[model samples]
Every structure is written in structure tokens, then in C-alpha cells.
Target: MARLGPLLGALVKIRWRTLLGRGSAEITGEVLMLLAAGLMAERFLQYLPEFPVVWVWVGLAVCWLGMSRGPEGVPGQFPLTRGDRMVVRTVELAVNPLSWILVFVTGRISGWGLCLILLAGVEWPTWRRGKRVSARPSRWPALLRKDLRAAVRLFDTALAGVIVLMFVAYAVREANLAVEAAWIVPVVVALSNSTIALNAFGTDNGTGFDRYLLLPLTGREILWSKTVSLVVLVGGQLGLVALAASWRLGWEMGLVVGVEGLSLLFLLAGWGAWVSVWVPFALKAYRFADGGSVWAGLVAFALCLGPGMAAARGDWWVRLLVLWVAGAGCWVMLGVAGRRLERGRERIRERLP
Candidate 1:
């Protein structure tokens, strides 16, 4: 046993020496990270005397980062492994003065706080594990439908009922002129329904089933399903909004806004679908190496807001016309892109490599 212990200790010492001599770059990087962390902690702690509310904000910020990042590697070519991240965070918690200071200032000794601290510092093992793409190409439609059902099921029934009641209460309180009040419902509906278009593809983070690729459904079929789903979702929201507007704005104003809002819903939903398809194509075409497509989507989203805002402000006829035109344009673009994708499937697959 003593002989085995000496051998194990020697191995450990050798490994440590090897890691220590890996490179000056690694050492520099560690130094920079420690310095930056220290500066941030100092700044946060210094502000506590003047701003008591800042602690919660800091906690929230830390929690958000921990939740979102969860143990990913550093942003470089030689990114830290998940285990490395865990070790680093553990060391920081033990040795860093700021960790103690943060604990002291926050007074968060509960299990949740410990969880957050661990999450903030621990390297999640799932990160950077090359994703396994299922090579099945025959079951995309069922897969998408499953996700669609899941999306619908995910909404809280009680929360939605509460939202409805709140809308009614607000309408009753705010209604003065029926025409003006009627517009509010449709606008709310349009905006809320627009959430259905969130980056469905990106949500999977490359690990989840590539449902579209697995199914025999063409891009057109997928687009159609998405469009239909959006129409139903938007229509439901529009109906609710129209009811609310009618309560506050008069029947005529409600009708006008309802129609306009429905049109806007179609336009926004269509555009969102179109962007989703186009983004993947653009990423493939440009051969963007990282998360550049997310940035591109953000830019597109920002640009789309202009038409939405304009349509929201006008009378029923004007809003309807604007939304109709916008919707038509988006539909046309989607059709063109869908056709292009369908025709260029082989080329796209080739580009992916």
C-alpha cells in the first residue's frame, strides 16, 4: 500500500508539473481572468453602501449568466473543458477574497443561493460535447407536429385566464371613446401572437432532433405547417383582442383594429417563418463559423419592428392596407426562398460540410 501510494503521488506531481508548463499563454489567460473577476467584484461591493437594491440586481444578473452559460468553456480556441471550469470555480470559491465578500454582502446562505453560486462557477459537462445529429431523414413531420403540440401544451391555462381577466378589467377601466379603446385589444393580440415565431430551429441547440431533416416533408410542407400554426395562434389572439377592444372602443373601432391586427399577425408570422428559413441558408452560404446567425436574426427583428409600429398607430383602413401589403411581401419572399431551398437541397447539403 505504501509503495502504491508513492507511485500515485509521483504521477500526480508529474501531471501537475506538465499542466504548469503547458504554455505562458495559459498562465497569462488565468491572470487576466482573475484580474477581471477581481475588478468586477470590487466594483459591485463598493456600490453596496449607496445602493442596497443593487445586490438583488447583481444576484439576478449572476443568476441569469449562470442559467444561460451554465458551464460553457471560455471564448477562445483553447477553451476550458467542463471539468476545468468546475475546478477553476471551486478554486475561486475557496481562495478568492471576492467570493467571501460577495457571500457576506449578499447574505445568501440558502440552498438556492448555493445552487446559483455553483451554477455560476461550475462547468456544465454537457457544454462543448460535439452534438450528435440523428441521421434519420424520414420522420420530420411527426417530429414537428410533436413539438407543435408541446408548444401549445406548455402554456399555463390559469395564467392565460388571468391575463384575459386582467385585459377585461383594464378595458372597463380605460374605455372612454369606444373607437379609440377598441384598437387596444387587436394591438395586444398581434404583439403577443408574434411570440410564436421565436427561433424554433435554434431552440434545439444542435443536440435535439433535427425534426425537419428526419422527415420526408419538404421545406414547403414545413413552411405550410408553421404558417398554419401561426394563423391559428394569431387568430385566437386576435379574437380575444377584438373582444376586449369592443368592450372599450365601440364595435366599429374594434372591427377595424381586429381586421388590421389580424393582417399584422399574418405579416409578422409569415416574415418570421421566412427569416427562420433564410437564416439557415445564409449561414450555410456565408459559412459563418460561430453564432453570427443569431446576430443576423436580431438585426432582421429590429428592422421588422418599423412596419409593425407604423401599422399599430393608424386607423383601421390604413393599418389593414399596411399589414396586407407587408404580409403579401413576406409571403412572396417565403415562397421564393422555399422554392430555392427545395431546388437546391443537394447544394445546401454540400455547403454544410
Candidate 2:
């Protein structure tokens, strides 16, 4: 206690105004935690016969529909105008029907449910903020790193909770068969890991991510660091899932699952990290002047869904080899393109006029 006296005294000497702000922040945090707990507890109740999973899904659907019908005048356009309204609506649009359907049919929501929540909270906030923050000519690496770190911190608690819940569910219910469970690790990793890099690269203003060309760092290096950070985080999570699933199955299956998970994680992270560069270009075809809109995102999403589903369902080895080749090609092409574009006069129009 004596050793803590100075520290306590120093803390007390801090501004009261800062303390008040922090106190409010703490209260907000507690409220959010309580809300999440209540939601999850409601979900847990679905285990009882009186509370069918189907009914739970119906309730979720209702909540989503309620939220989607926002303030009377709010435009339901590509990019929502209001943050709170957008948050409420987008979460409903993204999660409700599909996730509810999945949970109702399968009795459990896949990692995709977690991904949806993340998209609503983190990716949506970035888009909403980016709309207001004009493109200042800045280095891409610094911006990318800042965004990545901010996003990780933003979604950390929500993600950790969802993963823990998944772990508990898998452990207690033995819901997944040993073989299918082994597959789940790789499938979930492959399915979910790419969005981080993808969203990071895509979530900028009308200037697009191309302004990175003006930076001192080579595009390859910028891409490399982003890919590395994304891969490490996703790979680490995949590894943990493998470790857990391994305890259920034998070591052999465990090792195989782990390798599969890593392969998928790296493959998608690399591909997504690279293709993220083309987002601005691809998006140009859909909507050039309306920058950072969720409607544009929805279209890009639809374009990706077929390919993503194909890749996810294909033979693991074949898909892995194909993705490896595609990723290598993208890496080389993106470098060449970055250098050419960086040095040359490529007049890319702003997405927002």
C-alpha cells in the first residue's frame, strides 16, 4: 500500500474534467456490455424447448426490421446520411435475414455472424467518418497502419466476446462432428479473415487508396506490412481455434486442420490485401461520384459472394494452389501497376463530385 501512495496521489492530481469524461465513457462501456450480455443470454435461452431457436431467429429478425425502419426522413440511399440511423439500419440489413436464417436452420451462427457485427460497428463507422474527413494528401502506409490499429482496438472487445462464445458453444454442445469440426476451423478462417485487409484498404474517401503512391514507401512494402499484420492476427486466431478443435479430434486431424486453417488464412489475406488495391477501380464501374457508400459496398459484396462461395467450397488443395498462384500474380501485378501509376499521369476521377 505504501508503494502505491505516490501513484494514487499522481492519479488524483489529474484534471477533474478528464475524470468526468472518463466516467461517462466507463458508463457507456458498461451499458454496452450489459446489452451484449442480455442479448447473448436471450440466445442461450433458445436451448429450452419453450424457446426454440427458430423463435429466437424470428425475434432477431423483428429487431432487425425494427431498426431498419429508421427515422422518418432518413434516406435509405447507398450511403446513409446519419450515423446512428445507419448503424441501426445496416446491422439489420446485413445480419438479420441471413444470420437469423442460418441460426434458425443450423442451430448456430457461423463466424459470419461475428463478421457481420464487425462490419456494422467498425467498417461502417470508418465509412461514416471517412465521408466527412476530406482526403488530405498523406502517405498510405501511415494511414493504413493507423486505420488498422484503430479498427482492431474498436472491435477488440466485441470480437473477443463472440469468439469466446463460439468456443464455449462448440465445447459444450459438441455440435460439430469431429470431421466437420475439423473442417470448420479452416472454413471459418478462410471465410472470415480476408475482410480486415479488404476493409482497411477500401475504407477511404473519394481519392481512394491510390494516394498512397505519393508516399515515400514503396507500394509493395506498404502492402507487405498490411498483409503481415492482417495475416498474423487472423493466423493467430485460426491457430487458437485449431488448438481447441484439436482437443476434440486426434493430433493428426488437429495438425491437418491447423495447416488447412493457415493455408486458407494466408491465401485469403494475401489475395484480399492485394485486391484491395483494385477496389477503387472496381468501384468506379459501379458508382464513381458517390464515395464510400454502403450501397456500393453491397454491390461489391454481391460481386464477391459467388467467387467467395466457390473458393470456400472447392477442394482444399486445389483452391489453395490456385489461390497461391493468384496471390503471387496479384503481388507482382500490383507492384508493377503501383510503380507505373505512381510515376505516370493517370487521371482517376474523384468518387464524390
Candidate 3:
């Protein structure tokens, strides 16, 4: 344990430098956005007479997504022992608390804060270890399977799902709640799923794309593989939320949530594929903006909210139509994204360090 300190520091330093190298402008923009968000949140808490429990759910979702996903740095090319991996993760876990400092500053520290802190502590040792992928045709399944495994291994994802289920159970039991408020369930699911879908191809920072380009596979095939994996991952989260809502709120509300959730997920994954190729960003150790992640979040919010609004109106036919259109649109977008990825391989290569 004594020998692990230097190793962890060195790994964290490398990851930090890689993140800052993206660009000064990009980092500045993200920081500004974050500050603005924090200020807005502080104001919301101050002035809003009745802060909905929905935001609590959203906060938990964000915490889970952020904590469960492992560090995005490229895995060391040399072999690492289990101890080396554990030390590397310890460094990553040490950084998690810095985010909560914002909450403390905003004077919002409460049971929720304590709960999230405790949860992060409990899950810290479970960070997914990075894997080395080979650039071979037969390795595609292995690659996809690895991603699927990571998705499930995310302790935050599972915990967030359970919390959502409990919330649904409570919401369904309340007779005074407006039907329009049911939209929150799907919206939350959409936001939660987007954390993974939006960075589909950029999951391993910018390192994997180089190997991907080397593989004897068409961009379309690669894109499809990623899409399938994302659907499986994000779809699982959305499905759980839908099932819980259905069980508690009756099949009618559940049907709406299901359609809305699926539509939003498809839109996010399809659009994310295009972004992954066209505006590809690196999911660096400290930064989230590799490939227009901020813009993607904004776009996802807009898209998700649209379905939520439609759901609140209680128009089942309209909701179904929206779902059909979004599904078809994603299909077309995926094809275009594949072609773009192929054409832009040189550009993507240049973006990587």
C-alpha cells in the first residue's frame, strides 16, 4: 500500500494533462457552463417555494452516472497487475469529492448530500478497470461484450434504477398528483441514459478510434455495433423505469413512458453517433467536452423535453407517432453517421494526440 502512492499520482497526472491538452477554449467554456449551472441551481433552491422531489431523483441519477463509469484514460500499453489497477482507481476515487464541494458551497448540504457521499464511498473500489482491445474483425463481439459488462457493473446505474422504482411507487400512490407530472419519469430516464449514449464511440477517450480505423471493418458495421450496444445499455435503464411506472401507474401511463423513453433514447444514440464522428470529443479523465459533449447535452435535453411535453398532454396517438418518427429518423441518421465516420477518418486521426 505504501508503494501505491507514487503510482497513483503519476497515473492521475497523465490523465489530467491529457484532458487539458484538448484546448483552453473548450475547458473555459465547460467551466463557465458549470458555474452558470451551479448558480442557477442555487437560485432555484432559494426562490422555488416547492422544490419537487424530481430534482432529487435527477441528482441521484447524475451521481450514479458520474461515479460508476471508470476513468476514460487510455489503458497502459504495458501489462498492469491487480494492485496497479487498484492504486489507479484509488486516485480516481479521491477526485470524486471535489464535485460535492460545489454542493457544499451552494449551502445545500443535507441528508441527500450525505447519502450520495456515502454511496460514492461504498462504490469507489468498484470502478471498472480499463481493457485493451485488439484491432481484429473477430474481436468485435468481445469489444461489445466488454462495454455491456461495464454498463451492468455500474453500481450507480443499478442504484439509480432502484431509487427511480421507489419514487414511481410513491408517485403512483399519491392521488393528488397531476397526470402531467408523470412526464418527469421518462425525462429522468432520458437524461440518465444520455450520459452513456452521447459518448458512444468516444468512450475510451480518443484512443480507440485509431484502432477502429485499423480494423478491417466498414464504418457502418462499427457504427451498428456501437448502436446495438448503446441500445442494450440505455434501453435496459429505460425499460426498468417503464416497468416500474407500468406496475404502479397502470399500463396506460407506463405505455406513454415507454414510448417517450424509447424515442428519446433512439434520438440521443442516433444523434450521438453522428456527433461521435463529426464532432468527436475525448472523454478525458477530468473533462467531459471531448466531441461537443456540452452541446450534445443541450440537444438531448431539448429532445427529451419535447417528448415529455407530449406525454403530459395525454395524447397517446401523438406520442406513438413521435416515437415512430424518431425511430425512423434515427435509422437514417445512423446510416449517414456511418458514411461520415468513414469519410472523416483522417480528420478523426488528426484529433487524437
Root-mean-square deviation of each candidate, in angstroms? Answer: 12.3, 15.9, 7.1
Which residue window of length 10 is worst by lDDT in model 3?
Answer: 43-52
**What lDDT is obtained when candidate 3 is compared to the true structure?**
0.62
For model 3, name the residue pairs that clash: 280-291, 281-290, 281-291, 282-290
Ranking by TM-score: 3, 1, 2
Each prediction's whole-model lDDT (CA): 0.47, 0.45, 0.62
lDDT of 3 at 289: 36
lDDT of 2 by residue, 1-353 (tens): 35434433433343233334445545475346436545654544444343344344433333333332222332333343365444444444444343444335334443446444533443343345436544566445455555554334323222333443454345445644346545543453333334454544433433544555455667566566566666556666667666766777667555655656555544555445444544432221101111233443454344334334434466556545545654565566557544543443243223221
Descending-lDDT candidate ranking: 3, 1, 2
Which candidate, 1 or 3, has the higher lDDT? 3
Error of 1 at 237 (Å): 1.9
Model 3 lDDT tens row, 1-353: 66666666776676566556658886676566455444434432333233343444345434544543454454355356777765665466555444444334323534456545554554554553354555466656777885665554443234435445544545544544445545675576556556556655545545677777788888888888887887776677677767766776689877887888788877877877777777665444323333455777788788888778777774788888888878887898888988988898888666555
Higher-scoring candidate on lDDT, 2 or 3: 3
CA lDDT, candidate 1, residue 225:
63
